[model samples]
Target: MERGDFTDLPGLGKPLEDLGPAEQGHDPDWWLKRLVEREKITVLPPALQLRRDDAALDDHLDRLGGEAEVRRELTEFNDRVRRVLYSTHGGPPVTTPPRDVEEEVRRWRARREERRARRTAALAAREPEAPPPSRRGRWWPFGRTGAAGPSDG
Candidate 1:
């Protein structure tokens, strides 16, 4: 779907669609870092002053645990901010509708249950008891012979 379509969604609002081409090349990781930094600047509290100092921000973004931690923090902050904005603006939550797709799911579940019940009932009805073997005739591995013993021609 187009960026506008995603933005028009009830709760999605306006998510960043483009992070711009990297200076060197179209590096996804570089774009991700830029996006994360931008999101942090926009969503996080200025009063907290987490990245206020340029040196501190660079150090924090470059430490051993920096990339993963920064990405995670940015993601969480963005989600919370989005949720608050959507709720304030009367946008729907991200949850799926119970009636929309659920009706078909419920119908499928019911049909599956009914089929299982029918199969169980059919199996019970068709169950056969073991019977004793009869010794009326000599049963040979090949076709039956006219006489019980081997032919004495």
Candidate 2:
């Protein structure tokens, strides 16, 4: 189906392709109603349902780690789905604008540098100064003080 067709389904705020193939084939209203019915059957407290859903999502994310494209697409899909579902359910919106990644990277680098500095200072504080080498009989092998040359002459 075309992307625009998804708009005909109730509470589906974005294109079908964004939600992954599994959700795209199903009607949004039908899925929402099924979810509601499941909640009713179990009579789970809303908080518990949210916790369970979050745990499932975390497990899925763990499985998807190191899959960069899948991770990015899934994150986008989750954000879109959450916004649509929460809005339809009359809850506070869970959506936020995308972050400024450059700024975030700068902050991360600064924090890393601070941590490195602290570790280096702690190591220096615990370490003792190295002792000087003994010089009584040690001689450079290539210097003019070689033992064989003058003695043989």
Candidate 3:
């Protein structure tokens, strides 16, 4: 206790930060609920999940490789959206329409090209690599091609 090992810890003496629900009055499990929300734990229905995925689909598509892969992902996403749309055992209605595979693929291609162009331009803007130092002058220090210096001449 005398060693002060616990000193300088973050928020050592400060009151705990109040999570939002405390103002609304106490639920015994508020901490648990807050934990779940903070962790982004989703128990959302298929329709809602699909909506979230729809909004971030382009970001997801950019991570995938090749047109075929992008097409496949878009098709799978569309299939899920359609399924939720048609299903009767629903929660919220599926508002996210199926993405157009061709259109998404076109966009993915354009993004890829733009990234490539940026990389190429960045490389072009950098200083040209200096030529490798010549080895010919090293071993033959007397002169290049063993030519005599003025002192020797």
- Clashes per prediction? 0, 0, 0
TM-score of each: 0.21, 0.30, 0.60
Best-fitting candidate, scored by lDDT: 3
Ranking by TM-score: 3, 2, 1
**Please, what are the lDDT tens digits per residue for candidate 1 over residues 1-153?**
655666556546443445454454555586667777878845434322322432243243334243346555444544544445455443333332112223433444565567679999998999587888775544565665565766534
| lDDT of each candidate versus the true structure | 0.48, 0.54, 0.83
Lowest summed lDDT across 10 adjacent residues in model 2 is found at: 92-101
Select the stronger candidate by TM-score from 2 and 3. 3
lDDT of 3 by residue, 31-105 (tens): 888889799986888888998899999998999878888988999998898888888884887789998888888
- Scanning candidate 3 in windows of ten residues, the lowest lDDT window is 144-153
**Whole-model lDDT, model 3:** 0.83
